[model samples]
Target: MNKYRITVADKNPLVLSGLETLFKNDDRFILTGTARTGAEFIELAAQNKFDIGVTGWEMPGLDGRAILDAIGEFEYHPKIVIYTGVPNPRIIREAMLNGAAGFYAKGDSTEQLITTVASVAAGQMVFPYFDLKKLQDDPWESLTRRELDLLDYLKTGQSNQQIANYLGLSVNTIKFHLKNLYTKLGVKNRAQAVAVSLSRKSNH
Candidate 1:
């Protein structure tokens, strides 16, 4: 049988040590490496040395979302399982849409983590329990990163000029992003856009 290659990443020393020990004990996996930060994991990933990457959602530099984004640029993409303490629904949803194979919370049992990693390595998706229908209904899922950033700035009640200056973008560029953002959120204007963003956040 071919053992699966696995890498574990977390900011906490104890968690990293624990996970390393856990995977080391399992006969099904070859513990490739462990990383204390997202950047370290990204470096490990770049080498294409592992088959599955089990990582924390929040890290010192890149974080889970950034890791997902960076993985897109790599030619050899390994499966990713986001193991987070917070387990925010929005982040979970985004991870799913971004091609993450699994999302495991720190609160879950280590045995479950093993099972999730195994399932994902077998080409199955394993994620925390969530409202699938609600996620399907959410317009926030349709927004691109740029449009999402613009929506966040809109939440702060900033003028178009201010946002443009802050982003180092022209007013026309900001307006264009906003127009797309509004359409994604099903809102007609800035006020409605902000309100929709807030409502979705509060629901989560």
Candidate 2:
């Protein structure tokens, strides 16, 4: 039988090594690549295709959310399943909204991990099932890195020019970001956007 190809991305070296060992020992799996950062994972994903991508919520250059957004541009979208220690409903909801077909919280058993990978690779959307209806319909999960950064600056009461200078982006570019940011945040202008951003931050 041909082994299922897998790639994993997590910041911790220990986690990387352990997962590598896990997959290595499994006759049914072939670990193709393991990365320490979301940026590296994206590069690796572009270079080689895999059966599934197992990622975490937090990463260096792009967080798992942004990684999902970036990969939307790829011609072939790999089946992504988040394997995260964070069991936050907010994060899990975001991952589900963003594009992860399934997730395995750190507390889940090793058997569950293997089963999840197999299920997702076979094109199943494996949610915990009970929590789907409870997940909020917040559009906040759709915000990209740049868009979130723009809103972060706005939270500090930065004007367009100030934000442009702070981010080292041109004002025209800032305006472009603002347009998309407004849409994603579901706000008409800067004030509403800032209020929404700050409110969400307090929740976290």
Candidate 3:
């Protein structure tokens, strides 16, 4: 039987070495290649088939999310594991929505890392520090999908015009949604709205 082939990508040399060593000691995983940039990972992924691709959230070029997006468009897409130093719930949710199989924080325990990879490789979702159930129980549950989208765009510091362009809505329509979102979120301004939304999201 063939072992599961894995590719690890990160901008940090130490992290790359550490990951290589960790997988090298694992019997079920074959560490096929390691890359220092998202571009390099994309090139390697295009040239060969991998069962899993582990990448950091932030890198010199392309970033992990962009890499995942590129891979999702390919005919042969491998399961993606986002290994990052940042562990924001919003970012984690975005990764899941973008086709990532799992998420692992860089400071997580070695055992946790091993378990997450194993579970993800077995076709299960793994989120190291997030609780999906709690997120579902947020008080903002009353907010509609469009309201949530508006809030998410607000959190990204997008102006009404930019949000309108991205969501393919007219500026007036976006403004209307923003007003409703602020009312539901009980905030007075964009800064307060974003703060309230993120605070509630983190409590989950």
- Using lDDT, give the best candidate's number: 1
RMSD of 2: 3.7
- Give each model's whole-structure lDDT: 0.87, 0.82, 0.83
| Cα-based lDDT at residue 19, candidate 1 | 97
Task: Rank by TM-score, highest first.
Answer: 1, 2, 3
Tens-digit per-residue lDDT, 1-204, candidate 3: 557899999899998999999998998799989999999999889888899989987877677667888999999879999999988676687688788999999887977888898888888988756777765565474465467767888888989999889878799998898788777667788999888867877997
Clashing pairs in 2: none
The local distance difference test score of model 2 is 0.82
Candidate 3 contains a number of clashing pairs equal to: 0
Which portions of model 2 miss their true places by more than 4 Å? 130-134, 137-151, 161-204
lDDT of 1 by residue, 1-204 (tens): 779999999999999999999999999999998999999999988875788999998888777878888987888878999998988677788888877899999998999999999999999999888886876687675565568778888878899999999878899999998888887777899998888778878998
**TM per candidate:** 0.75, 0.75, 0.66
What stretches of model 3 exceed 4 Å from their correct place? 129-204
Indicate the residue-level lDDT of 112 in model 1: 95
Candidate 3 matches the true fold with a TM-score of 0.66
Give the lDDT of residue 201 in candidate 2.
78
